[model samples]
Target: MSDRWQEMAVFVRVAESGSLSRAAREMELSQPSISRIINSLETRLGITLLLRTTRSVSLTDAGTVYLDRARNLLAEMEEAEQAARGVDSLHGVIRLAMPVVYGTRAVIPALATFMGRNPDLRVEIIITDARQNLIVDGVDVAIRLGVGQLDDSTFGARKLAVVERMVVAAPEYLLKHGTPTTPGELASHDCIIQQGAFGRESWRFVRNKTVTSVRVSARLWTNSGAGVTAAALAGLGIALATPLMAEDELRSGRLVRLLEPYQLPPAEVWAVFPAGPKPSAKVRAIVDHLAMSLGEKT
Candidate 1:
């Protein structure tokens, strides 16, 4: 009601800079104006936000709590402003977090084309199997693969595509060890397993609407999806991999899909963002680009 957002922005900058003079310099506002804003904010909120001295300013306990919330509010405010303006010509660095496998195989290539189209936009991709918090990690958008519904509803999700897992091995490995026809028989075969989010090497398969999880001995177990793909390519053993991760290998007949009749638990690819007001235009643009490109492929 009282231009609270502006006050919050000024407050956050002051907290970060640790002095009114520094914050004023950074925000291009007079030091007196910055002091007046802080005074007005503290009076309105009925709380002492800063302990000011001749040379420094520090947040009180109340200020510490408010600062955290203020930062998020300011970010959402800027995003709302940008979205309202439109997404026709996007220009900014978007910090995107996604799984290592998909990020490398799909997102990286799509980004190449996206950057070519929008010469002004830059993307920073954080590739990891671990899930990252959008606000805490400062990630604008994140691509996640999950079975059916995502567990956390605090983040908004745009369904991109369905990810199908294939039990695959190199032709040389299959030729030497003989491909198993049933999911149960996987117990006897040497299976190269990539550790999934569940922190286990159990591979889940579905047939006739019934799901079964097979805990196979890993000829080699690794957290890296690329490592798993490489192992399978080198005739190490059977690995459960997403089609996109091994798209080229699958297409070129370097890796062969095994146990086709038995289905693996399918994952839905989602573009996720921190829950707030409508997403920023830059975020939407990248998410839309992924949906278009990945949708066609999947």
Candidate 2:
């Protein structure tokens, strides 16, 4: 490889890995080699690309800008080579992050279909409820749930779907505690809360432009969306969830939707990616596939 090309690639890997050692291991180069390449690149550019401490590596302001452009340039180059070779199918690995429950319930099926169509493409999924730092985690994409969860312009975002928020309870629980006729009655009932970034500690409802906000207390606080659904199914408490979480149960009459005609503001599902540069073809394709699948699910 040309010296400039190799140096920029190394620097991008180091930044994505968040450490010299990790980048070195991935590239099958010695740590010293990785460091030397970064140093040489910085020296040639007349600007520091990284601020390295004993334990961590962070991008300088200029480094961030360069990483963005360099990554885009390299990606485009690879894609160009693929196009020239008449490789029309997707290839390469995509590291995707998603919420634990949401991934299982909604994303997996979509991903399965997408992967099936592209035999050469590989996907690595990291499922969790905690917020992911996409660039730092080396994640190509992350599926974010709820409105306002992705508030910054530091990343590219696509609205996959507007998920309807439903308040539901097991028939047993409702029968025992009496079904809530109004959103106000929820205060007297035990609610199931999904904790973490997408948690709803309070529920909001709207009817004919009238808005109602109700703060709820839950004896059961679980971080997973599936946990909330399981709790509601076990007759533990009422839960605020999406149709994606309770479709089967709701259809089976195991869980009953509460407070009719009070339309809650629809929450959103987003496919988020690192800031700067348009996402690669693989990332864009998978995100679009997920959006289509989620639309069908909803």
Candidate 2 C-alpha lDDT tens digits along 1-298: 5899899889987898798997787677999999999989998889998999988899989998898899898778767866886765687678899987777877887877788888888788999987887766778888888756666467888988877888899999988999888888888899998876457667888998989988887788987888888999999998887887898999999999999789887878888887344777777788888888887766
Instruction: Report the number of the highest-TM-score candidate.
Output: 2
Model 1: lDDT equals 0.80
Q: Tens-digit lDDT track for model 1 on 145-196?
A: 7665676686678989877888899999988988888887788788776655
Lowest-lDDT window of 10 residues in candidate 2?
A: 146-155
lDDT to native, each model: 0.80, 0.83
In model 1, which range of ten residues has the least summed lDDT?
193-202
Error of 1 at 102 (Å): 1.5
Model 1 stretches with alpha carbons more than 4 Å out: 1-87, 112-120, 198-200, 208-213, 251-253
